[model samples]
Structure formats: structure tokens, C-alpha cells
Target: MFSTSNTLLYADKLTDFNMPMPHIYACHLSDQLIQFTGPDKKSYLHGQITQDVNLLTNDALLWAGQCDAKGKLWSILRLFNFQDDYFAITSKDEIENALAEFKKYAVFAKVDIEQNKNHQLVGLFGDDLSAVLSELEIILPTENNSTIDFKFGKAIKLDNNRLILCIDKKAQLPSCITLLESEQKWQSLSILAGEPKLNNQAIAEYVPQMVNLQAIGGISFKKGCYKGQETVARMKFLGKNKRAMYILEANTNKPFEATEVEQQLGENWRRAGKLIQTSFDIDTNRAYALAIMPNDLALDTLLRTKQENPISIEIKPLPYSLIEE
Candidate 1:
């Protein structure tokens, strides 16, 4: 039942997805959605993730995190209700290990988890979605975290300029919607949005709060006894967590590679943070990235890469407040 969409031809041999106009673009999210069904789905998941499972409804999506025993995240994903069942959408790099660990913890639960290959997610972005909405003939989601039904499957509005589609793999996309073959734009926008997404190499490296997950409404303090709840609650109450996710940008002459962020401490640079994701915008000719660093670091702090050809980078403010309260 799960398969790739043959209807979507690769425009890979063509130009890039970044159009001259800023927002008018669409690309495959390239993310995977895991389906959950059964009578006990709610009760079972309520005790497993950082978000309260009882909050899930047809009208909205909730950002959630599944963590390890020590409170480090296994993955951070978007959870939603499509029709009769629930779906958890995550990046492709996270699918294998996250799925394995997820199933391991569900052995006694009545809920069933599956990789729903019948569906695929499309990233829709533009200042004006009215024209695109008419082409698809779907209801538009009005607010953040809102969900709306479409011909293919379901849609979730991430913000005013962005929404995502989870459609049937066999369905044909409307000609009005220009679907991009590459997901690089999706990667850059997500970095600018400051939504923390982790790859396999970066998993289990930090607690959820260290990545500003709680700041973005991805964590619930009132949720009862989920896995690693103790560690999570302690971080908030004791003010023990000192790290946060930050958006960084730099004008570069060419593509740059960096694994860690370094601060200008006195004259010598020292390791300050880990770079989680990076993307280059063809239009702006600049590189953008997401890095986890000290929560109290001054904004626009001078930083660079540990690489030999170090690039100068500065922190940019996230769209959402990093404040916990």
C-alpha cells in the first residue's frame, strides 16, 4: 500500500525550485508519515511523547518529540489526524532508527504503527495561496497548526507563508502547482523557521530543551508522565538547561561546509555549538544554518566554523521567542 508517486516526474534535470519571486514555490517535503490506528491509540501515545496525545484533532497538528530514557530526543515530528487515523511525519533520515525504537516501545500497546507509503508530503509556500488553493480545490487552513482537507489527502498550515500537503502517492498533482524535484529550499526555510529537525548522525545528542523545542511549543510541562518527563521537568524547574537552537546566516563566495560553530573567545576561537542543518539560497547567495548553542549567548554574536576556510557567521533571531515562560 505504501509506494512512491509515479505521477511526479523528476524536474531534477531542470532549473532550481527557488524562483525570482520569494514565496511562490512548491517542493516535495520528502518527509515520511507513520500511521497509527486502533482503539488505544490515544491512551498509548499520551504516555509516550512530549505532547499530549489527547490534544490531537482533525482541525490541527501538534509538534511532538519522542525521547530516550535520559531525555535526549530520538526524533521531533509533526503529529496529525488525517481521516480515521493519526500520522507522525518526520524527515527521511530519521525514519529507520526512529521507527525501530518506536515499535520497540509499542509491543504491549494496542496501537499499530506503519510507514504509510500511500501518502507523500508537498511543501507549499507563497504570500498568496488563493490561486494555488483554487487549482487544487481544497479548503485553506486559516491559522498556525490548522488542518484542511484536499482532494489528495490533508494539509497543515505552518504559518502565513507556508503549508504542507500529505497526498495519495498515486494521485496526480494539479498543473497549477509547480512541484520541485529538490528539497533544498525546504531545508533552508525550515532552518529560518527555527524548527529543529534532526538527522541520524545528530540523534540522541541533546535534551529537547537544548534545541529550543520547548520554546516552540513542542514540549508540554503539564503532560503527565511521558518518557523522560522527569528529566524534561527538571530542566524547566531547576533552570538547568543552558542551551538553545539558533538561526545563523553568512554571505559566502561558494558552498561552505561546517560541522561545529566556534565563538571568538578573546583572540582564539573555541567550539561553541553543533551545526544541525545547513542550506544555501541561490537568490540571496548566502548560507543559512541551524545550530544549538548557549541560551544566554548574545544575539548577533560573532561566530565561525572550526574549518580551515572558516566562514564568518552571525546569529539571526528566530521567528518564535526562545523564552520558556
Candidate 2:
């Protein structure tokens, strides 16, 4: 069920066949992986993300953003050091577009931007991840706050809600596979992580804060202005007013289309928000979805899908702080 080429590497690790299935998948990027070199490298990225790049040790993984002049997040990233080179991984949805955008700005900068889909990324999840790794005698990365180049398995908190064991695809290890979580679990977990994806439905609908990007270390207030900085800063200091994304859980059998309207709001069946991702509990058959809703909406807001088995949903608190400032 897995394929490898001369340019690729693959390994499987022990995992529980029962609890939260482990999934191994590559992080495909349309935008080339930009390797920044030279003395100006740190300053360049420090100007980009929410966290101070200068503060990041070689082993630190920083959560950052590439935003528009108005501060709308064009892309989200996690950057770390790899030897003398610095690597950044962004979302697949915006990779190509982001790459094109960066090329225009690169101008005379000393950076090498090349599509590095050649370097596959394999991830392991579940409460048993550490146990399985130990069984294989693999030395997992230490849980140090410092930034270190990772060679094999290392558990990092993607956010407050989920922990991930990240492995470089090119590394050799015991049999380890990526167990793709069901659509519902994946979405629910993502929402809990407070990490938002730029899907077709959520592509340009909201700004960075609407998805709580800055609150999760995705934006840097001290950094020089990149694209969309003004808007993001204004919203943070002034207020978001009435717009923000919310996560809710409800029950229904109706089929739901993310970003599409499925319920009546007022005058007509207006668009409330988009169903960004979803996963179902294999045992309960209950679907949990992640969605973007108006900030004023209630947690128990009623929602229905258009399918014959209309799906129901409920709002839940994201496992992060959503501060006004």
C-alpha cells in the first residue's frame, strides 16, 4: 500500500492497531522549500513570523505566518534549522501561490527556493506514540524548548490539543507508517489545536485573528511589517468587533458541504460559516466537525444540513486563549 522511489525513503514503526489509528503521510508543498542562508537570514524571517526569529535556537520550531499588508494570513508555517540551512514548511493549499509570491519579493536576497517535495514528511500520532517508539529502540527527540535539528522521531505540541511525533521522511527507522485519522477526528483535533487550514471554503474569508493565529504563536507583533500587518495589528489593538471563527458540535444526518450554506439564518438561507474539516468516532458513528462561525453566535446555535439526513452541530471552546488584545 506504500510506494517508494530511488529519491524517496520509507519506514514503518510499531503502532496500536486499535486506538486512534496512526497515519503516515508526506507533507506535499507546491511552493518550493526556501532555504535562507547568509548573515541576513535570521533578520529576514524575524521580520516575517510572530515570534522573534532571533530568539529561536537552532533546535526551536517556530510557529509563524506570512501575512498581507492588512495582516490577513496568506500562509502559516513551522520553521526550524537543518544544519547550515533553514527550512520552512507551509500549508499545501497555499504553497504554490505562496512560492510565486515569495519569488517576486526575493529580488536580490541570498536564498535558494526549490520545490523540496523530494523530502517527504512522515508523522505519528496517538497516546501510544512514545511507547511504540521505545519498543523499536528509536531515540525520540528530547522535549527541550531549544531549537535543535531533528534526525528521527520527536514529539512536539502542535498546539494545546494535539501532540505529534515528527520524523524526517529521508531518515531510516523501523517500520513506521502514517495512520490517517478519519475526516472527523482530523478536523476536530485540528480545531482543538487551534490550527486553521486555508481550504477553498476558508481561503480568504477571514483574517489571521479570526482563526486565532497570533494567539497560537503564528504572528509576531515585534517583527517589521510584511504583507497585511496593518489590518492584523489594528484588529488586535482595537478589536475584532463582530467577526471570529467558532467551533461547534451538533447532530444531524444531512450531508454537509463545507463553505456552503445549509441552514436558514434570517431573510434567506444565508451562509453562516464553512465546515472546514470533519472526523467521525468509529465506535459512536458521531461526526465532529471544525467550522468558522460568527463571533456573536451561541454555543448551542441550531444548524441543519440540506441532505435528507441533515447533519446537526454544536459549538465547543477551542483549547486556547482567545484574548481581545
Top-TM-score structure, candidate number: 1
Residue 28 lDDT (model 2): 25
Off by over 4 Å in 1: 1-23
Error of 2 at 135 (Å): 5.6
Please give the CA lDDT of all the candidate structures.
0.79, 0.54
Per-residue accuracy of model 2 over 1-325 as CA lDDT, tens digit each: 2232322222232222234534333322232244566666676666554556775665577767676555556666676676666666665676765566556656566655554544544433454455445644544445522333344534344422234434455655334434342233444445555566665455555677776676667667777766677787787777754566665555434334444325456755655776655544443344556666676776656675444555666567776677645
Total residue pair clashes for candidate 1: 0
**Superposed Cα RMSD, model 2:** 5.6
lDDT of 1 by residue, 284-316 (tens): 577888888898899867899778889999798
* Cand. 1 TM to true fold: 0.91
Q: How many Å off is the CA of 113 in candidate 2?
A: 2.5
Model 1 misses residue 323 by how many Å? 1.7
For each candidate, give its TM-score against the true structure.
0.91, 0.75
